[model samples]
Target chain A: MLDLSTIREGDSLPTVVKPPISRSTLALFAGGSGDHNPIHIDIDYAKQAGFDDVFAHGMLSMAYLGQLLTNWAPQQALRSYSVRFRAITHIGDEISCSGRVSEVFQENDEPRVRIELTAANQNGDVKLIGEAVIAVY
Target chain B: MIDRSNIGKSFPPYAVEVENHQLRLFAKAIGETNEVYTDEKAAAAQGYSALPAPPTFGFSLSLSKPNVFEAYEALGIDLSRLLHGEQKFDYIAPIHVGDVITLHEKITDIFEKPEKRLEFIVIQTSLVNQHNEHVGEMTNTLVIKN
Candidate 1:
């Protein structure tokens, strides 16, 4: 559980930087997530679709953001999580996931905290922006 | 153009059983090292009766239904041109391994941006466990390039 007493607005969660995305990782994610979209794994299909190469799935980044939250608190503590895909994450891009406490409030008499989250590549290009609410003790 | 008339259309409810190996594979694919997602003992330590599904695992469950792409086909969406625009999940309860989850899905909205030559489809799903408890809800927006 997240310790509400020890948290303050604006406090940052530890950042998680993943190794550069690789084709095998993308292939593995395709099977893992059951998203077999050719744009994400088949390079020839990607070229046929007007892209020069395959890109990472948006859900992959969202999953990384989920990992960031779970790293701070247990999974059951998560109340809600949402994300908007801002840009395509291409292969070879290293993703850095980060979050910060955005608000502290009570819902249904239970203390909760809202976190603003982000996933960006090594070049600092933001790929996804998201928010998560978690119950705090 | 997507048929706006499909908005509010509900699909047949489908059920999927949660499995431990699936969770482990998903955890590995996402590079998750959290034992709570992979080990029953660690999950018990966290007060879970069984291994807990990772936060985004529900998305995979929602797709587990046979003919998962039929909805898009009915919506006139060419899978080749589709992109995931956004996703949201509201957790009412934790989903655990061995739970049978039933999903109810519907088309909530459809719209187009002529200026960008883009079309958007919003689908909402409600998840209920075998015990008839609401466990989670998901909203998925898919964007199609014109």
Candidate 2:
């Protein structure tokens, strides 16, 4: 459990890494997210589309970042979470998400914290990067 | 090239019913092990009236609209060449299980970078619960590789 009282600016968040994503993970995400874009789950279609092979949904990486946030803070405290897809994450790529406190401030008399976040593959090529603003009080 | 005339267009609003099982499934897919996301008892223990939506849950709910892709097709976009460029969410209020949330999609902006042969369209969707409270807003940018 995260204690807002103990958190300070510049503190590093616990890194969360997911196992290498598989075709089955992408397929399950397709069903769960309602994103049936063949480019994500169908190898032939992905190849036909010029990609080397199927890739995970961009949202999947964003979800990993989200998991990192909610695990360290209260779910209801998230005020904003955003990300930009930087690189394609192919199947079997292990994505690791991490973040650091950017600042601690007050808004409407409530304590808030801003965190800069990143999700990168084993090669260190970032798959996504963004920030999350949370209400810590 | 996608027709630029679709800018500022708004699609009909659609609704998606929040369900605990779906939330649990999504959590599992993303490798989320937090019990609050999958167990009602854990959520209640944490003070949530119901299982609070995972931070990115709104993205999945917004895509459930049946005609979400029709607007892109109408703009002459090649769905296969489309790529997600960016996504942002502003959580104004918590979304709880059992909320029949409505999603309203609006085409906020569209532009192109001729040198890069890329066209970008930004769609913003707002979520309102059955009680008519604004819950969240999600912005998605689709990059069409031209």
Candidate 3:
């Protein structure tokens, strides 16, 4: 069981090996995730649509947060996790993922925590907004 | 004009079986090496049948449910502007390799906000394993720019 008191609101998770977003990495994510949407793999198509280059899938970015949460509270069970895509991520962009504990409450007499998560580039622009609910025994 | 009727209808069930290699590849892509997701022996120690699929694994198979996004063309949806809004999973039991899952989905809710012209729909997809035990559930939202 996870104790919310041990994790402050702004506690940060360990950063993984991340570099400038690339077309190849994006394609790998698409293939592995089975999301073959062209907007994430075709640079020309993305450029024609007003993007500088192919972008990463929003779900790929959000799923990264799952790694973060699982790393922090390995014992807690996930109830739900959701994120809204805010902006497009283009190739060569370095993404930073972060999360903050938002609320702690009880549901059906079980302890739960809500976290607000986000991933952004150095430009101070957000790429995704995520929220998750986890249950801790 | 779109065939509005289909917008709220769900097609027949489709089956999506868990594949160990797929889960392995997905875990590798994210640099994850958790025993629960990588080692069958370790997973069994934790009481799981096999390396349980990760949370978003549903997206890998959830789309297989019949008639997913079939009416988009009729509604003039560019297919290009479509984006995944959010995904939620409710686990009745963990998903493991060799589990043959049959998905039955239904359009549970639909809403259109005037300003956004965005269509919000919820599909509740049930997953039943080879042994016929319910393994997991998936709910997803797909957004299209109108």
For candidate 2, list the clashing residue pairs, or say none.
Answer: none
Model 1: DockQ vs. true structure: 0.84
Task: Please give the range of 10 consecutive residues that has the lowest summed lDDT in model 2 chain A.
Answer: A1-10
Candidate number with the higher lDDT (1 or 3): 1
**Candidate number that wins on lDDT, 2 or 3:** 2
Q: TM-scores of the first chain across all predictions?
A: 0.98, 0.95, 0.85
- DockQ of predicted model 2: 0.84
Off by over 4 Å in 1: none
In order, candidate lDDTs are 0.92, 0.89, 0.71
Residue B114 shift from truth in candidate 1, angstroms: 1.4
User: Model 2, which residues run further than 4 Å from truth?
Assistant: A1-5
- Which of 1 and 2 is the better model by TM-score? 1
lDDT for model 2: 0.89
On residues B1-146, what C-alpha lDDT tens digit does candidate 2 reach at each position? 66667778888889999988888778888887999888889999989889888888898898787766776788888878999999999988888899999999888999999999999999999999999999999999999998
Better of 2 and 3 by DockQ: 2
- The candidate that wins on TM-score is 1
Q: What is the TM-score of chain B alone in each candidate?
A: 0.98, 0.94, 0.82
